[model samples]
Target: MSFDDVLQRGEDELLSTRPRHSLSWILASQFTASTVTAFSKLILTAFYNVELKGLNHLDNAFQYAKDNNRAILTIANHMSTCDDPMLFACLPWRYFFNYDDIRWGLAASNVCFTNKISSAFFSLGRILPCERFGRGPFQPSIDACIRLLSPDNSLNLQKFTLPPPILRNKPSWVHIFPEGFVCQLKSPHENSMRYFRWGTARLVLEPTIAPVVVPIFADGFEKIRPEEIDMKTDYLTPSNIGSTITVNIGKAIDDNVIKSFRDEWKNLCNKYPNKDNNDDLSDELKFGSEARDLRSRVCDYLREQVAQLRLQNGFKEEDPRFKDVNFWKRYTLSRGNSDPDIQFVGLNWAIKEYQRHVKLYNDKGEVIGEGKSERPSNL
Candidate 1:
């Protein structure tokens, strides 16, 4: 599809999100992504001392997902803009050959899709333009991720003359930066991670089939592209060439834990007074308070899972105060003046708070009611 088509249908409907792509686009995307991956591998090997631990866990999870027709969802903490592609460099070379077996990721729309050329480049690399600030996590792009994690049969492949191999009885692989933005601590020994956004909770809870959830922890990427860079160039140049980068791939979350959480979500929906009554309403509107609470809990649990990896990697225990969203808000506000990205974080938090108090809407373009603005007492 053309860029105009993506604009008209909305950023969420980009051809990259669909099950199939034009042959030319598929070829281009594969070539571009492969080349980039190869280059990243070379850079890491030649310049940095990279250590990857527990790679077997990822291999086992990928194999299990492929055998059982289940999707694999990988979550990691974001410390740099190039973390996704750069981290993949540690994988075996065979992974770079098949585009279907590789992972699809989300990127900030404002940063990655500002123009046609950049949009096409990132899209071809299998990145979806997600609205991080304006829509928060309730936008259609988040819904698309849920659809992707569902069973392969949910996709419509007949529309394309030649469906890509990714559409043929294989589950998609999706990667998410749950922290939502680059979060570099002043000291690498600090165990704290930013509060994971609720978008990730939806990915785990709403999928038709529970995905194989794997958590990854990486360090030293922040040195590659430090938040306080001296250069003002448009290109993403790597710095601190000889830093030691360690990547730890934790085991997949237990299946029983995922099932129990899904069951609890179902119970909440069933207990609601108006479950399934509003077919046109989004889950946020239909399930209302229950979804919001469940999402928060799920996000916290997921964040802790990643934090466990950080501890395993020899970092100190996280500070208890970092668990509170308000703490992060205040922290960001304090740093907003000097760091522009931190300013975006503060603004996004405000926008999310505002959205919570605004009028809710159904898919049919009808206003339902005002949302609750009260923060939880414990929080």
Candidate 2:
């Protein structure tokens, strides 16, 4: 298809026929959010060793768009409640939209009547909402989402689209955590991981507008506390123990790869029905396998594994990866490449696998407990 066709098709498949939440609503929400965000910004979000890596990928995305006049769409992991907010907060606000309009947009799941405060907070800036499945009338809601995302529709673009000078700016990025919410639960002993939705992947692939699908990895927002609500009070820093709360965004992922991964997942599920399929195969396994590259294979496997992880813990396999748990686990142990995908692969692997090892190595290499030799010959 032609370049414009990609955007057109994506819009046809994704946008709303008639927008919801009037233009007035969108503006008022932003107006209200500006005040709230202004206040929230003043409320310092304490930092505990947060590291940002692989931004070169996003930088490249911007540079590519500038050179080619194309756009980029990013799909990130929704492993923490703070995910969506952090993404907007972390981006170069002045580049994508008016710096003066950098406001926190809250889109609560139809909590308009029951949870007014949260609803307002999330539904603000260019606030777009995805239907809460089975909650109520959803077709209308889906249309609203599509309208905002449609290139022809200026409502979504007015806020998200950059100016000509801005277009030449960096890649226009708007983050969508397809998992929809955080991964961890309140209980300390529980080992369940939250599931991911394909909406993220679909947004990347079906849209001809953005050929690159960047994968963002979050290493630790799933910390378990004795009293979950008291996370602030019981905050045990990962870096203190040698692990850093890392946010690694991988290079733009090609659409073809997702096709193969999804195909493999579906094939495996159809072929082998009884196995415990959970994690998204690509992450749990590896990527580049189809490219005859082991590193890619390993990455694809790992992504798949993350899906199973969520599945095992009651969040049924949302992505197309629950068909082969072995492939996912094996990919985790497999040595990976230096590719940016490797970082996303490795980081998630650490979340499910290398956690204890991370705790042992700090700025200064201090072992958590001395070896048996240092134990003074017990008995």
Candidate 3:
């Protein structure tokens, strides 16, 4: 069936089964232990020494948001199924510190129905059904986010438009995985990321607002069955010597690079903004493309770096796994062994440029997931 037809059915099905539930109420009731979760989540992020590169991008982003405190919208690349916990774990508090609400996550409608209990309590997925016309009916979360964000249509490029909901409210940060679902393919040949939906791109454009488009790529997160969220035993252990994951935060996307960005907001702002979107892509037809050349550059850069690490310095000094030809984790996940010529490259492609840092989450004194631990979880 055509994409439009599928979308129509999806929308129709969702509207018919529209579940009227209050997020605020659900969160308050389901997460009665939130006081417990807050402490745990905070300590894990703060002391863990989890550093983000290109964080200055968000630093500057926060400044732009100073006007009305319109919340920042972060677009992240989705890799693992269990990426949400890590998402909360990955970000620094300052990112969400200023706003009354920091974490706003979106999930495909399917996830809501499929895992209602979990989505309601622990890793609840907010259900939003999209129409073929790019509209969802009476979604409170979306409406609240849009209202809180107070998006100003004065900043967008033509092709991308922000929905009206974004303009009404002010949010600190809204985390969105535009891929729409979790990545669940196999490994050694893993990493067939779905194409990012343009909805996010449109949001960036329309709000006449430019949010910190934090492009993140997460590794080490795979299919997480609801039955196996127990980090104390099965999930948390070191899977494979080579089983390392990487999450990279790429540069932001802006109208400074798109002529359409300037044209859209020329009349709105007193100052005529500069429009020379620095794109690496040589697309002859598509205009105002900032991430146009992102794909080729990321691929090329990863391939070369990985190749160098394998052939030259080699990972033998740091990781002995690289010493054995059969122990291919280093070559596969390392920045030195990627080869573009080989179509079987893995997901490490998105994070090849990032430095991987690991900090242990010992429930030694802390309360682990769902009362498993005693030390308030974060320890």
- How many residue pairs clash in model 1? 0
Task: Report lDDT (CA) for all predictions.
Answer: 0.70, 0.38, 0.39
C-alpha TM-scores of all predictions: 0.79, 0.47, 0.46
Return the top candidate by TM-score: 1
Candidate 2 local distance difference test against the native: 0.38
- Scored against the true structure, residue 244 in model 2 reaches a CA lDDT of 39
Predictions ranked by TM-score, top down?
A: 1, 2, 3
Model 3 agreement with the true structure over 1-379: per-residue lDDT tens digits: 0112222232233322333234464455334334434654554444333434455665666566666445576665465645665545555555433323445556543334235565444333323422111122223334333332433343233433344212123544666665454444343334434444444433343233445444555544443222123535555442333333344555444535433543433332222222343211112212233332332232223222222322222122223222232333344455335543333222332221221221112323222322111222221
Q: Which residue runs of candidate 3 sit more than 4 Å off their true CA positions?
A: 1-51, 95-101, 113-119, 122-148, 151-169, 184-189, 223-245, 258-379
Lowest-sum lDDT 10-residue window in model 3: 278-287
What value does the lDDT take at residue 97 in candidate 2? Answer: 43
lDDT of 3: 0.39
The segments of candidate 2 whose C-alpha lies over 4 angstroms from its true place after superposition are 1-47, 66-69, 92-120, 133-150, 153-172, 185-195, 222-227, 230-244, 255-379
Off by over 4 Å in 1: 1-12, 15-20, 154-168, 188-191, 231-237, 273-287, 333-379
Query: On a 0 to 100 scale, what is the lDDT of residue 317 in model 2?
Result: 33
- For model 1, how does the per-residue alpha-carbon lDDT over 1-379 read when each residue is reduced to its tens digit? 0111112232235544544446677788789889899999988988888989989999999999888888999999887767978999888888767777777889876568777899888878888877644355656667667666766554334432234233434777889998876766554324357888888987887676789999999877776766555434623576888998889999999999888888877676455534434222235433478778878898898888888998887888876756777767776556444333323311233333322334455655355755554432322
Please give the range of 10 consecutive residues that has the lowest summed lDDT in model 2.
Answer: 370-379
